[model samples]
Target: MKYRIGRVLISEGQLREKVKELGAQIREDYKGEKVIFVCVLKGAVIFFADLLREMGPEVDAQFDFLAISSYGASTVSSGIVKIQEDLSTDIHGENVIIVEDILDTGLSLSYISKLLRERAPKSLEICVLLDKEERRTQPVNVKYTGFKIPDEFVIGYGLDYAGHFRHLPSVHIAEPAE
Candidate 1:
């Protein structure tokens, strides 16, 4: 498929390597604790799938999904987030790791963190596949970060441009059409 861009920013191999690192870190930090991995939906589906596969032989974790929205069909955030789907299971007494494709404005992640915290999870954390710190208008921290990227519009490995290029094995910014 056409990438709509000339080159890849983060190749599939690069992302996979980071995921392996993330999994190993989690295994070390959590050690004996069990974690419920909450994957943000749509954009995170690919990342979540790949990440879980790499979490190691003995990492014990459950999985859930919460679909959130801010950009809708647009490629840019509007500084607001709405939950199109909420978690079906209670996070109370469970350790939670929130997994996401990219942490942009930090609004959606921050909002989800608060919402999940209200459930009184034993411990809550965030793991991001990509972080664009410059674009952040709100302060947000991620426990596991795959890459720190320039504040550019990226698509692939679950990131998208009006729902395009997600199947690409890497990340690329579409050249603005003339």
Candidate 2:
């Protein structure tokens, strides 16, 4: 069960350092306030877990999961976003942060953000591990971003190709076999 991984774009050490830095920044930004971290599930689970741990005891954070899909099992998005799962907890009046693995095309995040905004949270923000700015179709305001990558087919560090290659510690562009 081996997958062909392309050149490593971001190393494991880099991700660790960035996550810590982002966590510290998040703590400072939301100081004295409790934040409900809404993780975009499946892909973001790994990054979300690591980020929460990095936030340490100084930050007051709760968590929920929202599963939205635009990409099925393929490397490219279908351009249509669908909510596979919804939040379990009520976020009304709570400071909400949407945690996502990658911001590609911005369709899913944009749709999710709009949906969450309707819930009337005290504040709403977005935190993403990776941002593919070049492929963005919609303008999404991401508050905290770990990395801004070019438009590439990437996998690992929680990103995946058809549900595979997520266990890799580093991020790499996926070079499909001919």
Candidate 3:
């Protein structure tokens, strides 16, 4: 099942600029403090790496990965959040940041935040690359947002349909090829 890329939703340049901005803001916000960036796995991997590089070398930062699945092969979430993988670190008394690819229904992220909060981190916040608020069923306090996109099945730039289109440099509206 091949898919076609339609209109460009987010350009690569825009992604780079936003990543740099988010990184700078986070660095300033946690200056002189050690921070742990907890990356939501698979989808958030690219954004997390770019965000970390954007933060530069000055900010004291560590990273860990946590994987949760709400959407399997479907475009819409299944509404069932499951922890596919858990973080190895304790995170107690540590400043924690949850880096996510997109905040759509917020079910998965909401679950993630609640689970992390239970660990008693010194601070916990969310940083997301995209926010599709039209379908939001749960509220998530996203501290850093790169873009507020309309409700569309977007692909590329770490967002994917099924397991494809994630390697593309820019985001695009996904469509079926005739």
Candidate 4:
């Protein structure tokens, strides 16, 4: 079941521009308040790092990492969200943002949002680098969206297929190797 990286779906330049825009939007929305960015681990780590840099020193942005897994070694999600790691910081009464790599069926993020909301944060929102609306099964609100992509198995830029291609600078479709 080998796979090959296909055409660029989102270029590195596009991602950088979108991240900057999202950072600006977040700064404006939060209005100089402190923000706690909870990075969804593994896939979102790369996007999280790049996004954080956009925040700059002027913005009081704090960050933590939590690992959630629905896809093990498969391209498609297993539909069961599991928390491999949890955030150490208490999010109660704080401006919290969940940064994710992609929103597909929306199961993982929906589950995560529900759990976080129960913690009673002052605000809870989602920021995703990619949104695949065609595959959304659960309704989840995404406050910041980098790109609305089509229904394709995409890789690169923190997205991956069976744990490969996550380090690629740009996003690419994951197609059959042949």
Q: What is the C-alpha lDDT profile of model 1 across 57-148, one tens digit per residue? A: 57777899999889977768877889999999899999899999999888899899999999999999999999999888778768899999
- Per-residue lDDT for 10-120 in model 2, tens only? 999999999999999999988777899999988999899998987667778999999888888878889998899999999999999999999999989989999999999
Model 4 has an lDDT value of 0.92
Error of 2 at 152 (Å): 0.7
Predict model 1's lDDT versus the native. Answer: 0.86
TM-score of 1: 0.94
Clashes by residue pair, model 1:
none
Q: Candidate 4 has what TM-score? A: 0.97
Clashing pairs in 2: none
Residue pairs with backbone overlap in model 3: none
* Cα lDDT, all candidates: 0.86, 0.91, 0.92, 0.92
- RMSD after Cα superposition, model 1: 2.2
What TM-score against the true fold does each predicted structure earn? 0.94, 0.96, 0.97, 0.97
As for lDDT, the candidate ahead, 2 or 3, is: 3
Give model 2's TM-score versus the native structure: 0.96
- Which digits, one per residue and each the tens of the lDDT, describe model 3 over residues 1-178? 5578889989999999999999999989988888999999899999999999877677789999998888898888999999989999989999999999999999999999999999999999999999998889998999999999999989998888888899999999998879
